[model samples]
Target: MLRVGKKTAEDTQTPNNEIESSVTEWSEKVTSLLWLINADHILPQSYVPEGLENLPNSNVQVVEEAGRAFVRMTQNMDEPLYVANGYISATAQQNLYESKRQQYLEEGYTEERASMVIVDEYFPGGADEHQLGLTFDVCTDAALNLDVDFGLTPQGQWLEEHAWEYGFIFRGAEGAPKIYKPWQLRYVGETHAAIMEKLHLSLDEYLAYLEDKGTSYFSDVGAMHLDLIVYFTDSLSEIPLKIREVSGDNNGHYIVVCYR
Candidate 1:
């Protein structure tokens, strides 16, 4: 267990497997963040990828923006997701193709039954959110962007209320050329999620906040891995972000996000 005090990301640790209150549990992950890097990304060691096969044949749709290729997928199909999933190198595009194929098979799909377009010839990396496999895209209306009424679907609500639980954060919000996607998700894990949700942040605001706080919260050396739970498309949402305090700091300042 880990005990976290308010206002800092530091805590005292307990032996593993010791159960505690919600605060302590979040504190545990916060304090022991050094061990969570492996679970944060799909490369190296994939996180608890239990139901990847069941994720459906996430069509390989590509987009080219500013001279880069980005790989994306369409929406849900008429069937449930399968249970045949695995992870390989991060930069390797083949792993994505294979995962999609397996997912399609699990959905009772055959070659003739393969539906959806495959635009894998080129990819334009949209943003960090895509690299971490956190946020997927959707066609959004430009005029009403960021309007709460526009993003009220169950999935959209999940992105708003629970995406941070999976280490994903909201990015690229609040400006032209960079739109605010309530549907967009990034792998910021628990700390970012908790704080952002509590703060009700958009992508642009969140990044600016991180930089201003001088918190090496993302993609930087000596950065800390915030904790979070990943709920697959078919699974019950994990790690509720219902406002809670995480571990506190002693050696240095901590930016904690509480979760279970």
Candidate 2:
């Protein structure tokens, strides 16, 4: 498990001038958009995203904001992008795990090796990002399947350069641990996406970094004119400004970002 930090808002420092705004200005829905989900931070089986919208020409569904951003991304690109995977439920994930595990066993692999392979390739049930409607795997018509080779293609290259603008991050990019599928992208909104990309941090590392610091600030990122004040806290009452975004670290704290 990742180490959880215990920094409270009172322990952190903000700039001399704080933004005078109300925390209720931003919707509570922003909280779930950037949630850190993985094996160590498993998603609950009962969890399901609100207002999921179906992407065009795909069986997959994603949150409305993510779906809209994806549409914008596709429209801006010269070639078409397709959703290869999105929003897998716990039951569906179990089926996929069993299928792959059985295939490995059929290939004369031992039970332990088969299980290990499954864990590396596919997370079981509630432990996967696929269970979250905010994550998606993309591919082009020529490359319907996800693989490292797709990263060499025009679609992948374009996404690498511009996905953050649409609030998506390449989840399996460099510095990411375990399975590294270049096609996997997770929605964390534009501001945080820009910050994560700038720091070259995977979601896991980024969360841990912020937790250690207790607080951070950024200016003029992603066409956002106002300065951003970000901090980690387990208690909501400790935040000093209007919370623009709040994401659970999944390790006992909320990563709060506010604008001034």
Candidate 3:
């Protein structure tokens, strides 16, 4: 098992000017990549992920970084990987939400129950991660379907074991509001994904883990022996000037990642 290193307050005495400079230098693009999206943190209808591009040989779109990672992952796989679904537009998500809601209603569920079911089972519009362009559903070329059965396939097994090396995490693996999707992957960057996989933490659990710790350090991540310095705080001034990335935790807080 990979061990997390001891936490330290090494930067506590850093000058205020440095911290402020960090805030100004931090890339907003990096900060937005991992924003948590759920019922409680629903995105606005006008929200759209920037720099979306078509995945190689597929019409499905995702953020440019995510697309590049996805391509690299598939190229390394034995059996070809296929995208079952990718980025969803706000309007399309709303339509899908209505369609599922109506279907549940037709199945004899009350209006209120239908809404609740969809919100829980099928995300409603802006409440979905698909709208973020950082999530994608994958399947093998042999069976182009999305289901739990895919988890048993060679492609799925490969992803489960090695996707973190390429920066993807198995979403909803072990947390609340669980939808139990084995075929879905979300790009949270290589460092974060490595930590999450090593610790067997779901996205929610990972965020909560960092929040509880305030700051954490991990050494020798993967074969690269990379040292990771992670910090969770709402104060922008606390962000280090030389950050690898920053992401919103969907709880009015920010997660800052640095390499040491």
User: Any runs in candidate 1 off by more than 4 Å, and if so which?
Assistant: 1-129, 138-150, 172-180, 215-260
| TM-score of candidate 2 to 2 decimals | 0.85
Model 2 CA lDDT for position 149:
73
* lDDT by residue (tens digit), candidate 2, 103-169: 9999999999998777777777888777778898888764567777778989899999999988999
Per-residue lDDT for 105-217 in model 3, tens only? 99999999997778667777788888899999887764567777778989888888899999899884531265787888999888788888888888888888999999999
- Report each candidate's C-alpha RMSD, comma-separated, in the order given: 15.8, 8.6, 6.7
Model 3 regions lying over 4 Å from their true place = 1-19, 27-29, 141-143, 173-178
- Provide the TM-score for each candidate, comma-separated: 0.32, 0.85, 0.86
Error (Å) of candidate 1 at residue 76 is 16
The lowest-lDDT stretch of 10 consecutive residues in candidate 3 is 172-181
Q: Which stretches of candidate 2 lie over 4 Å from their true place?
A: 1-30, 173-176
